[model samples]
Target: MSTLPRSLLKNLDLFRSVSEHDLDTVLQIAQTMRLQAGEPVFQQGQVAENFYILLHGHLKVVQTTPEGEQITVRYVMPGEVFGIARAMRRPTYPAACIAVEESIVLSWPSSEWDHVIARNPQFAFNALQTVGQRLQDAHTRIKELSTEEVEQRVARCILRLVDASGEQTEEGVSINFPITRQEIAEMTGTTLHTVSRLLSSWKEQGLVNTGRKRVTVRRLDDLIRLAEGQPPGGTAASKRNSVEPL
Candidate 1:
């Protein structure tokens, strides 16, 4: 296990607010690990022995449905802490985390968590906030699944990806990594064909551009308007109720 750099340690949510002296203590108990794309950081139901703070790259949290279909729960980005089964008191992971790109992460043994939390109560508070945000995102996704049309769901998903990991380019805002139509289907509870068709329509309308593994939003405002079921230039108040807090 490589030692974590002070810069990376300071950026982690779990360690960000700690005093430098306290951070040094915490760093002494942590180890850094690297994962390649498609690597499994941990498997669902495996003993939960460690938690992680990602320093670079992306991870996808996924659950296997009863029917054995893989459902994407969320994407974990750099500076995010994951594998919190220890905090939740689970003996094993509820979902599997797989690296979507070459990634670097800080790992702390589960046994050290209690000590760190005791020494830094703020760690626990930050963890709770992270979990709460994820829950809110899940709720928003559930609402989209239950009430929104396929087009609306895709629009929302694209917007969300942009928010999470979009990069600004001359073309527009592009989702920073590759994602498949099948994955989009799983995330939105729709069919791949539906997603592809909607994306195709958006492409024609100058709303988006798609390639084999990426999608770029050429006109985000148009997609937002479509999400609200309103015409372009609609008032924020008119769409306020329709917009779900993420």
Candidate 2:
């Protein structure tokens, strides 16, 4: 058994729906682990013996292509669960998980997972919902990559990140954490030069403001226009209404 702070324990999804007694029982089997930025929590094909909930900072899920190029699959933020291979009954991890920032995580051994799920059907239902959402997001990204231009794909990627983890400021909505042009390129399957050029163009048009490692949307309308591949005007406004707000 490992000791964990009460505050962190309270926020984890697996514990949230359970009764107080169950929550305490679950915590008795949990361990807290700390990871440094750029540290590998687990490698591809590693044994899936434990599941984790991110308590702080960010994690990147990545896979390498046959050609040896690394591609980012998704960014996992605090309060999100990762290492679900055990729960899903996979013997090994499908993708590698790395800390994008210094992070803290709560881990439960695979043995406890079966007991928890058997006792709490809600946990199983929630896990399925999370998987479904991820599948939808993957499908959307695949469609964008197949059909959209590099600029539009990049725009949509940024918009999704902002919606997931953005902080509102007087200037605009800032992505909650730092991101690099290289990471953006990897995510959108575009060249670094292309990302830089497109972002510069948006800046010139007053659509965004870029800092050293941050991006803020200044004119959301203009960004939306680029994302939809539409000329700036009435068509963009109509599209905006249909887009769910972040």
Candidate 3:
């Protein structure tokens, strides 16, 4: 009871159509879990046994590279549904989900999915929507990777995070999650050195202020300009020099 995430029907748009009784019935199949930061909720290629709804805190989706390097695909915020590999008919997870901080989730076995969705049509709709969204996000990332340079991709990634779960503060707009330069580099398909150097340059130009596990955009417009290849207060001559490996 206490484990149930703030009524799913209220927080998740896809579940809005489900009645409390229906929602509760589905939840009856759920098991609540608390995970420590850095712990894995699910590993890549593991059996797909459960579907999860993040109750609190954050999660990172990661995939392994050919060289055995782990690249971050995306970050999940609270109230989102994840671990839907069964919905895709995959016997194993394609990627891993790890907790970014102490987090809670409600999970249900894949075996119960049909029963749950049949009794709650909205559940089926929502599951499909969630999977569809993952496809769209992947498509967008592919476009960015092919069309944008490292700096632009990194800038867009930061802005996307800020837009997703940022909190406005006296300092500036900060991403409301624990993120490291290595993870950002992985997410943008670049090297950590590149991300660190670009961030250092941005800080000097007053475009952004970064801290441990936090990034605050001081000039979002300028960052957007930079992402579009517009040199912000810096000339074209300096742009190449400012962002190395361009």
Alpha-carbon shift of residue 108 in model 2 (angstroms): 1.1
lDDT tens readout by residue for model 2, 65-161 = 8898988888988877778887777999999999888889888888787787776677777777778889999899889989999989998899889
Across residues 1-246, which tens digit of lDDT does each residue of candidate 3 receive?
444664644567657777777777776777888999999999999999998888789999999967898889999888788898887789999999999999988888989878877877776887788789888988988999999889999999998898888787765678888999999999888999999999999898877788898888866667878888887775555543342210
Against the unseen true structure, what C-alpha lDDT does each candidate score?
0.82, 0.80, 0.83
Ten-residue stretch with the least lDDT total in model 2: 237-246
Report backbone clashes per prediction.
0, 0, 0
Better of 1 and 2 by lDDT: 1
lDDT: worst 10-residue window of model 3: 237-246
Instruction: Identify the candidate with maximal lDDT.
Output: 3
Provide the clash count, candidate 3: 0
How good is model 2 by TM-score? 0.89
Which residue pairs show backbone clashes in model 1?
none
